[model samples]
Target: MWKKWMVCVLTLILSMPVVACEANPAPESQPAQQTLPYRIEVLADQLDVPWAMDIASDGRIFFTERPGRVRVIQSGKLLSEPLISFPAPFISEGEGGLLGLVLDPDFANNHYLYVYHTYKEGEVTFNRVLRLREANHAAQIDKVLLDKIPGSSIHNGGRIKIGLDQRLYITTGDAHEPIIAQDRASLAGKILRINLDGTIPADNPFSGSPVYSYGHRNPQGIAWHPDTGILYSSEHGQTAHDEINRIEPGANYGWPVISGEQQKEGMKSPLLQSGDTTWAPSGMTFVSKGPWKGQLLVANLRGKQLQKISLDATRPDTVLEAATLFQDEFGRLRDVVEGKDGILYLLTNNRDGRGNPREGDDKIIRLVPIQP
Candidate 1:
């Protein structure tokens, strides 16, 4: 009877479940990871080195191809024929060609468009800003707004935008001459502001001069903050120190003298820099809606990504965070613009002689933000 009772006790002890105690217990839950609010969709494909773009109030998209073609997309379709083609045989080697296109603020009434392109006169290379008139689905050169900007096979900074004040802003590179960036007299390496009629603003920082700000190496993009109207510029830095700067009138950005975080007494440092990383940032725009509103999106060429930059809410000049999206998904992004409907439009520059082209080569892509 004792042996049977011991066996029963052993069986009961063996049948009971065992629980081990952990030194540190995990929390009940973990925070979920956050994701981007938009997905990319291809709007048009097979484009040839599209450089810059702008959307019209009627939903028409006007863009410039590096090879002197101005194409249009209407009703969600890219037209087979270009709206107008700038006379070729111009200098398109490297970064020079037909670049920088923007529609007039009063385009609906005036049907005016502005463009910047490289040309040669008597063996001298130069860049000019021209106004075009569009009628009957065709455009012709209307007037030469500004001219005599130095151009080169590389470092021909060409990006144009009309500000809220109705003044035209143009970015010009140093034309491969680094020292000219500090010379206020040179049109190269400068941000120029002019009236719609191509006249220098009376309130310009320099009287009778179009130079708004100087000391830029190769500034390729410029955009104004949606709420503050503060202008920002994206510049290609020497030795992988790409910069995004808050532009002030007559301010010196210190191109060759200082880059990245190096500061000088009278020069304004960049709001954000890539440090050792090379973004080769091109066109940039501010988000107007959704979770990413007030942030800036920059298209990177060599980095082949769309860089999202957040700024401090209290300090508009301070950069809060920097992140990237769609890395290597598209080859060589050139421009990103916010559409009138609060969506984003992107351009791929694979065929620009520097990227590995995919099957479709170049494309126009759209990003629709996910609503809450």
Candidate 2:
């Protein structure tokens, strides 16, 4: 009877169930296929080393050629006559020239245009910021906003942009003297914020100077977030460590002192870094309105392509995605700006001595968004 009971109990336990330790979850679904939503059109060709461009509120597109000429494209027609030209002593050497340009916030009434370029004083050469009056034929220099920032052949950071706060911001390279980037008294290797009249902003981080932030190394591209109003900058590292940083008041971006993967207290790290690859990023623009709205369109010279960086809506400084656009289709892109008409414009740097210039080298191309 006992043996029969044991057999029955064993059978009951065996028939209960077989339990495994853990069950495997199914694999996550693959991401959706990315479809680019823009078609390129040749807006203007034969441009010689176009560096930066901005569309005026009056729908006039003004651009700068590195050889010291400012050309206008009105009503989609490239004007045969040059709008303005810089005279002698404005040296176009190495990585320097008439680099950054911007129209005034009140340009319609004020008629002010600002530029950052390399200039010579006696035997000394330096970079400066000038505000000029745009007239019918030529522009007149109204004010020399800031001058005598240290300049070098290669590291003369000459990109400027107006922030949402209506302040003019400029980036300066270290003049190849990395030590100066850490000096608060010097403007080299720093991001400067100044008033429209080229005076120091009352609320600047520096008490009486225009030094907004310090410790930068050849920052070239700067733009403001349309939503969050934060400022972003792209800079070149020594050999590696191409970086994208969000600028803030009194912030000291780790440069000269440190590059990437190295952090210290009171020093800020970059948002994104290209570990060992050189993007050689130049001018960048934030798409204001279109299918690619809120995205940053950056021009890469060494990379010879366009990079579209998607910003996190909730955190504008956070980079959500980054992809190369028109890879090698246009050689050595230099600048990108969004037109008021919701079209994206790109400037090629093929004529910049280092690039492979095609037939109509260094052209201006527009990116037309595809409609669903």
Q: In lDDT terms, which candidate is top?
A: 1
Off by over 4 Å in 1: 1-33
Model 1: per-residue Cα lDDT over 20-82, one tens digit each: 222111122112246867887899999989999988888899999988989999999999989
- Root-mean-square deviation (CA) per prediction: 20.9, 17.3
Clashes of each: 1, 0
The C-alpha local distance difference test score for the whole of candidate 2 amounts to 0.83
Candidate 1 TM-score to native: 0.89
- Model 2, residue 39: distance off in Å is 1.9
Q: Which window of 10 residues has the lowest lDDT sum in candidate 1?
A: 23-32
Give me the displacement of residue 101 in model 1, in angstroms: 0.7
